[model samples]
Structures are given as structure tokens and as C-alpha cells.
Target: MRQQLASMLREARHAAGMTIDQVAAHLLCSPAKISRMETGRRPASQRDVRDLCDHYSVDTEKREQMMALAQDGRRRSWWDEYELPRGYSNLIGMEAAASSMRDFKSSTINGLLQTEEYAREVISSYFLPANPALIDQLVAVRMERQRAVLRRDPLPDMQFVLDEAALRRVVGGPVVMEEQLGRLLAITSELPSATIQVLSLRRGAHAAMDTTFTVLDFPPGTPLKPVVHVEDVFGDMKLERQEDVDNARQVFQRAADAALSPGESRELLEEIRAQYEREQPPER
Candidate 1:
């Protein structure tokens, strides 16, 4: 929501042929303040929005529309209660509004599809010497995010392409993994708009071998650009440039092309689950 407002404001500013400094001068504010407003680093006040719209000579109807967007941007998301890192919160905001998404995971299950036990285990592993309360909060946030797939008015179309190694990684334990696999199957059955595919090891050394990323597509009426999100140990990065987004899109397509079909992927998942069940220890 904030991104949508920022994009529209930036576009209007550019169309007006006014420099940031010039806008700052007109509004009697520092250039940094103007920059933050256009980049969504800070909230834009109603008066500030009106002043900018007037300066840009935006039609009254469009100006009102932008103001409405600004108002919407002020509403807090449920994730806000978790006190997430800035980068994570920004990505969640974008994800909440995305109409479709393509995800590639090379190391582990995507957060959106993780079952509660799987998510708890993954979080515990990462935040070793973990705080139990914090771990619970993190798990809750992830579970809430899964609602995007189940959203009904206009369901989000989602495709996940996973490296086969991810399935074999053995998160939690055999029983936990078995449950996770079952959850994945349930998700596919319940959400027709969601798909899961596996890129077998046999398709060795493919593109995007070292990266895990997601590309989010928004509805057409807004000025929001398609964004590619990349996360690493350092932090998360949002790629908005046309070239970067295009490259990410192509990478996802290539990986998807190399993955097993949805039916085949489900069959493989079942086989893996059976292996886990067989390996489970007998009653003590």
C-alpha cells in the first residue's frame, strides 16, 4: 500500500518536470523530506499530498485518488504486531498486495507453505539459544501469511519451484518432514491457484543455482512496479528496476521449465513421506 502511494507520487513528480530540490523549495521543506515521501520512507501528510498534487497540476480526480491511497497506507498490517525487521515488514506489505507470485527455493521450504511444526523447527534452528516467546511470534506471523493463498475474493496465483535437495534436507525430523509434506499436498488440493514443482537433481547445474528469490506481480490499475525480493544473511533487497525484474522473471521461468510437473511433484512428495514413515522408530 505504501509502495503504491510512493510510486504514484514519484510518477507525478517526474511528469511535472520538477526537481526534488525545487519541490522542497516550493513546500518549504528539506530535500531529504521530499525524497523520503517519494520513496515511502515516511508517511505523507494529507496537506503535503495536496500541495504536491497542486504543484504537479494533477487533475482533481487523480489527486483525490492518490490521497485515498495515502490514507490506506496508514492502516497497520497484522504483521506489525510481531515487530519484524524493516526489510521483512516491507516485503510482507508487498506480498499482502501482490496479485501473483513466483517463488524459487533452493535450500528449504518456502515460508508461505510451511506447516506449524516445520516452521517452528526452522525458526528454532536459525535463532539458536532461542527465546520461546519470540519463536512462537515468528511462527504465528508465517502462518498468517499463508492466508494469501486462501484469500477468496480474488485468490493470489502462486507457483513454487523447489530444488529436490530442499525436499531431502530433513528439517525438524522424519516425522515433522512427513507432516510438512502432507501439508503441502493439502495446500495444492485446497488452492487450485497454487502449484508446486520440483527441479530434480538430474537437471544438474541449472540457472539460479545459488539464489532464492520471489517475484511479485500487482494488479494493473496501480502504479506499483513488479518487484523481485532477494534475502540473504545480511538483509533483504527489493529490485524495482525494469532490467532487474525482467532478469528475475526469466530466471524463474527457466527454473520452472526444468521442474517436474505438478502431478509428478506430488507423487515424489508422497514417496518421500512414505520413506520417512518407514524410517520412524517403533514404539519405545
Candidate 2:
């Protein structure tokens, strides 16, 4: 929401043919503050937005739209209640507004598609040094994010491409993995907007071997541009520069092309789930 507002303000300023310095002077603020507002680093107050709109001479309808966006931006999301890790809040904010998403995971299932148990195990295992309470909160946050795909009014189009190794690896033991795979199969069968593809080991040495990233696309008429989010052991980074977004898109397309067809992917997932089920201890 903040990004959308910021993009609109930036575009309006550009259309007005004014430099950051000129706007700052008119608003009696430092250029740095205007820059931060335009880049979404700082929230724009209602007065600030009004002042900008007045300066930009934006059309009445567009001005109202930007003001409404600013108002919406001030409201906190459900994720805001939790103390998210550094860099995660921004990712969640973007995800919440995205109309579609493309995820490529080399290590495990994408968070949006993860089952609750799978997410809990992954969080607990990865953040071993963190408090148990914090891990649980993180798990809840991830589970809540699934709503983006599940919501009916405006369901998000999602594409997930997983490396064969991610599916084959026994995460959280056989029982957990079995359930996770089952969840994946259910999601594929139930959600027409969701597509899951697997890149086989046979087609080795593909792009994106070094990272797991997601690309988010917003709806038409939104000033917000596509963003590429990359997560690693250190932290998460949101890439917004045109070149960076373009490169990420190309990389994801290449990886998708190398992956099996959706039907084939489902077949493979079923096979792997069977393998995990076989490895599980018999129930009493």
C-alpha cells in the first residue's frame, strides 16, 4: 500500500516536471524527506499528500485516488501485529498487494504454499537459536499469508517451480514431508490459479542455482512496479530497479521452461509422497 502511494506521488512529481529540491522547497522540508516519501522509506501523512497533489496539479480524480491510497497505507496489516524479522515486513507488505507471484525454491517449499506443520518445522529448524515463541509466531504469520492465494474475490495467480532436490529432501522427517507433499497435491488439484512445476535433476545446471527468489506483479493502473525479492541466510532484499526486475523475470522464465509440465509435476509429487508414505512407520 505504501509502495503504491509512493509510486503515484513519484509519477505525479515527474509529470509536474519538478525536481525533488523544488518539491522540498515548496513543502518547506529537506530534499531527503521527499526522497524517502517517494521511495516508500517514509510514510506520507495526509497533509503531506495533499500538499504534493496541490503542487503537482494532479487531476481531481487522480488526486482523490492518491489520497485514498495514502489513507489505506496508514492502516496496519495483520502481519503488523507480530514482530517480523528484519526485511520480512516489506516482503509481506508487497505480497499482500500482489495480484500474482512467481516463486522458485531450491531448498524447500515456498512459504505461501507451505502447510502449517511444514512451516512450523521449517521455522523451528532454521531458527534454532531463536525463542520457541518467536518461531511459533513466524509460523502463524506464514500460514496467514496463504490467504492471498485462497481468497475468492480476487485470487492471486501463483506459479511455483521447485528443484527436484527440494522435493526429494526429507524435511521434518518422513511424516512431515509426506503431509507436505499431500498438501501440495491438494493445492494443485483445488486451485486453478495455482501452478506447480518441478525442475528435474536430469536438466541440471540451470539459472537460479544460487538463490531462491519471488517476483510479484501488481494489477493494472497501479503505479507500483514489479519487484523481485531474494532471500538468503543473511537477509531478504527487494529489487525494484528496472534492470534487476527484468533480469529476475528472465531467470524465472528460463527455470520454468526447464521444469516439467504441471500434470507431470503433479505425477512426480504423487510418486514422492508415496515414497515418503512408505518410509513412515506403520500406525498402531
Candidate 3:
């Protein structure tokens, strides 16, 4: 909501033939503040929206619309309850609202598809020596996101291109990985718009081998720009420039082309699950 508001604010400013410096002078604020608000680095308050609307001589109805958007931008979202890094929290919120998403997961399942146990292990491993309570909170947040995935109105497009390496990597051990694969099957089945393609090890040295990222598209006719999320061991980042977004999409398409078909991916998943199942301890 904040992002959409930011875009609208920019468009309004552009339409009014005002420069950031001009607006800042009128509003008695620094040009940097105006720039941050327009770009969504800092959210614009309702008063700010009102002042801009008045300055632009916008119609009454349009002013109301911008005002409502500003209010919604300030509202707390579901992910705000937990003590989370702001970037990660924003990513979850954005993922939930995206109209479509293409995710290339190099090392693990997407958080929205992870089982509770799998999530716990992943979180605990990364934030080593974490308090037990924190791990529980993190896992709970992941599960909540999964529940939201099912309940979302007007289901979004979900495309996941998973590396076979991620599928084979033992996350929490044999049994855990086995159950995690089963959860993936179940969750993907539940999402009617979901598509999964597995990139086998045989398809070596692909275009996306060096990155794990997700590209998100917003609804048509909205001002929300498409975004690319690049994630790594260090952290995550949001790339909003059109060129960066286009480049990410091109890379994703190339990688997806070499991946297994949806049917083939499911077969591979089942085969790996059986392997893990067989590795389980024998009954006494």
C-alpha cells in the first residue's frame, strides 16, 4: 500500500509540473524528505498527502482516494507483530500482496511452502545459538504466512523453479527432509495457480546458478512497479529499477526453459521422497 501510494504521489507531482525542490520549499521541508516519500523509502503521512493534494488542486474525490491510501499505508500488517528485520518483514508483506511471482530457490524451499518442522530447522541453523522461543516465533510466522497463502482472495500466480540440489539437501535429516517433500507436494496441490519445475543437476551451469531471487509483478493498471528480490547469505534486497527487473525476468525465463516439466518435477519429487523414506530406521 505504501509503495502504491508512493507511485501515485510521484505521478501527481509530475502532473502538477512541480519539482522536488519546489515542493520542499512550499512545504518547509528538505528536498530529501520529498524524494524519500515519493520513492517509498519513507512513507508519506496523511497530512503530507493532504497538503500535496491541495497544492496540486486535485479534485475532491481524488484527494479522498489519496487520503485513504495514506491511511492504509500506515496500518500495521500481520507480519508486524513479530520482532523481524524490516527488510524481511516488508518482503513477506509484499509477497502476500503480489499479483504474481516467479521464484528461483537455490538452496531451500520457499518459505511459504515450508513445513513447520522444516522452517524451524532452517531458522535455527542460520541464527545459530538462537533462543528456543525465538525459533518458535520464527516458525510460527512462517506458518502464518502459509495460512495466508491459502486464504488470499483472488489467488496470485506462484511459479517456483527449484534446483534438484535443494530437493536433495538434507535440511533436518532423512525423516525431516522426507516429510518436507511431502508437505511441498501437498501445499503445491492446494494452490490452483501454482507451478513447479525442477532444474536437474544434469542441466548444469545454468544462467541462474549464481543467484537465488524472486521477481514479483503487481496488478495491472496499478502504479506499483515490478520488483526483484535478490537474497544471499548476507541478507536480501529489493530492486525496483525497470532495467534490473527486466534483467531478472530474462534470467528466470532462461533458467526455467532448461528445467524439468511440471509433470517431470513431480515425479522427481516423489522419487526423492521414496529414497528418503527408505533411509528411515527399520522397525524393531
The positional error of residue 99 in candidate 1, measured at the CA in angstroms, is: 1.4
Ranking by lDDT: 2, 1, 3
TM-score of each: 0.92, 0.90, 0.89
Per model, how many backbone clashes are there? 0, 0, 0
- Between which residue pairs do clashes occur in model 2? none
As a TM-score, model 3 comes out at: 0.89
List candidate 3 stretches off by more than 4 Å: 10-26, 30-43, 54-62
Per-residue lDDT over 1-284 for candidate 2, one digit per residue giving the tens place of the 0 to 100 score: 88789888888998999999999998899999999888776789888999999988899999898889889888876877887764687788787788999999998898878888888887887774778888877888887877744774677898999999998888888999999999999999888989999999889899977789999999987878898999887888988888999999999999999999999999999999999999999899
Best by lDDT: 2
Question: Who wins the TM-score comparison?
Answer: 1
Order of candidate numbers by TM-score, starting with the best: 1, 2, 3
Question: What Cα-based lDDT does every candidate model obtain?
Answer: 0.87, 0.87, 0.86
lDDT of 3: 0.86
After superposition on all CA atoms, what RMSD does each candidate show versus the true structure?
Answer: 1.9, 2.3, 2.5
For candidate 3, write residues 137-162 as lDDT tens digits: 98998899888865788888989999
Give candidate 1's TM-score: 0.92
